[model samples]
Target: MTAATSISPIPVAPVGLTARARRFVEVDSVRVPRRGLGQHRRKWIEHGAPAVEIDRAAVFQDRWGGLALPPAPFYEGGPRILGAGCPEGSTDEGWSFRAGSCRVSMAYGFRIGSDGAFGIDAYRWTPLHASTDGWVESLALAAHAGRWAKTVTRIKGKAVESLDLVGFEPVPEVQGVTDTWWRGKDSLIALYRGEAVGLDAPRCLEAHVYGGLDEWGLHGG
Candidate 1:
C-alpha cells in the first residue's frame, strides 16, 4: 500500500458566535436594543424637560482608550472603555454590549462643572423581546445597574463626596416590579426590572449633585 502523504487541513480562523449563540446565563435570553442618543432624548422629553447637555470632555477626562470604551479593569484615573462601541465625542451617545446573557445599553448624559458639581442621567434599556420571566428581567436590570455603578466609580473616583440613587423607574409593562436601593454615607445602589420601552415611553435613572468631587466620592466643598 502506498504511504498516504499526511495533508494538514488549511487553518481557518474559528467563526465567532453571535450574541444569541454564546448565551451561557439566564440573563442572556434577552437582547439589547440598538443605541442612540435620539432615543434617550425622546424619552426624556416625553417624561419631562429636555435632556441635559452631557459633558463629553469631562466624562472621558481620565479615559485612555481611543474611539471605543474599554472593559474593566477600568482606567485607574477615570472611566474605562468596557468594550467596542461608538467613538466618544457627542454630548449624548449610546453604548451597547453584551454582559453575560443580558444585552445592556448605557444611554447616558452628564454635566460636570468647574467646581466639580455635576449631574449624570443614565438610562438602561433592553429589547421588549427579552425573556418575559420577571426574575430574568430583574437579573438583567441588576447587571446593568452594576455596570453603571462601576462607571460612576471610575469617573467620579475619590472625588465623589455624596452619591445618590436619584431615580429608578421601569417601563409600563414592568411597573409592577418595585426597584429599591440603599444610600450609605458614600455609596448607593438601585435594582429593578422592566420592559425596554422605546422613545414613546422611556425610563430613567438619574442623580443630582449638591457639592463637588472627593478622593473617591462626591462631596460638599
Candidate 2:
C-alpha cells in the first residue's frame, strides 16, 4: 500500500534569458588604487648597473572577476539600470559616468565553445576626437608612446552577431589565442594592447574560456 502525500510547486521567476551564455571580455585602463596589497610594481636591471631597481609604479595586473550582463540598450528614452552586467555583489559595480576613480567598466564579451573555442562579442569604446582635457591628454599619451590613442566604442545595444567581424579569425587548429578584447561600436577587437591589457582583458577572456561555456552557446553551433 502507498501513502498519499500532498506536494506543492515552488513559484520561480521566469529566467529572463533565452539561452544563458557566458562571455569573457577585457577592458584596458581602469585606474586602480595606487596603494594596497596588490598595488603594481615593476623591476629592471641595467646591463652595467649595479643593483636591480624595482619600479614600484606603472600598470600591473589588477584583474578582478565580474559578470557579463545581456546587452541592453543605453537610450536616453529608456530605463537604465545601475551596475548592468556585473556580478550581483562585486567590487566592479557602478553606473556609467560614475567617475573613473570608483569602478571599472565592462570591456568586452566573448563566447567560449564547449570543445574549447572562442570568439569576440561587443566592444567598449569612446570617441577619439573629443575636445576636452581628458581626451586631449589621452591622445597625447598615446602619441608619446608612439602609438594611437584608442577607446572602446559603444555599440548602443545588442551584441554583435558575427565573431569574424571583430577580428576573431577562424582558428580551426588552435584552441584559443593568447588574446584580449575591447568593446567597440557593434563589435570587438582581439588583441593584446589598446586598453585591452592585463586584468581588464584577461579576466573577461578567462570567463569565456573557462567560466561560461553553457551560457555562451558552447555545446552547439
Candidate 3:
C-alpha cells in the first residue's frame, strides 16, 4: 500500500497595516512622592479612585526581565495597575490609578524608601503603530510618555521631576529618532555652563540598541 499523503494549509498575511507601522517602542518613567503614603492613599480613596490590583508575576518580570511588550492598540484605557512585592495585607499594597487610554500598556512598581518617601519605576510599550501619517505620528504616540508620568503623579499626589523616553527600534544598530519628545505645546530650554543657550547649541538624545526578543520571540535580534 502507498503511504498516505498529507496536505498543509497555506499561510495568510495580516490585513490593513501599512509599511510605516511601528513595530516596537519603550518608555521609562519616574515619579517622586510629595506626601506620605498613607495620606496619598487616603486622598485617592476619598476621590472614589479606581483600584488597580497588582499582578505579582508581571511585576517580577518587569523589574527583572527588562521590557515586556504588550499586544496591539498598546495603551489600554483603564485604571493603572502596577506589580508590587508586598504581603497581601501590607499597607504597601500595589497602587492603582484613574482609568484612561494613552494607547499603551503600562506596567510598573512602587516603592517607599526607608525615609518614608515614595517613587515609581514604570515601563510602557506597544507592538505596532499602524499609522499612515509617517514619523510624526510615531513621535506623537511616544509623546504620551509625559502624560502617563503626569497621570501617575496625580494619582500619587506627587511631583513628576523627570520622565525619559527611550525608543526601542526593531532594527539593529540603526538608532531611532524623534522630532520632538513632548506631546503638547511647551517651551524648549537650553542651558550650558549654568547659562541659557540657543536652539543651535549641541543637544543629544541618544538611543541604544539592547539585543533581546520578547517572550514570544516575534522580534528577532
Return the top candidate by TM-score. Answer: 1
- If scored against the real structure, what TM-score would every candidate get? 0.18, 0.17, 0.16
Give a tens-digit lDDT track for model 1, residues 13-78.
112322221221222332122133343445444644323322232132222112121121211111
lDDT string for model 3 (1-221, tens) is: 22233211221112322222223322222111111133344444455443332233232223322222232121132113222233122244334222112234445333322222222223311111112122213322333332232221220011112323233123312111212122122211111110001122123222211112232222121
- The ten-residue window of minimal lDDT in model 2 covers 17-26
Local accuracy by lDDT, each model: 0.27, 0.22, 0.24
Once superposed on the true structure, which residue ranges of model 3 sit more than 4 Å away at CA?
1-22, 25-84, 87-221
Name the runs in model 2 displaced over 4 angstroms.
1-154, 163-179, 182-221
Candidate 2 lDDT: 0.22
After superposition on all C-alphas, the RMSD of every candidate to the true structure, in Å, is 18.8, 21.4, 18.9
lDDT digits (tens) for residues 19-40 of candidate 2 = 1110111122122222321221
Candidate 3 — worst ten consecutive residues by lDDT sum? 189-198
Sorted by lDDT (best first), the order is: 1, 3, 2
Clashing pairs in 3: 74-104, 74-105, 75-103, 75-104, 78-99
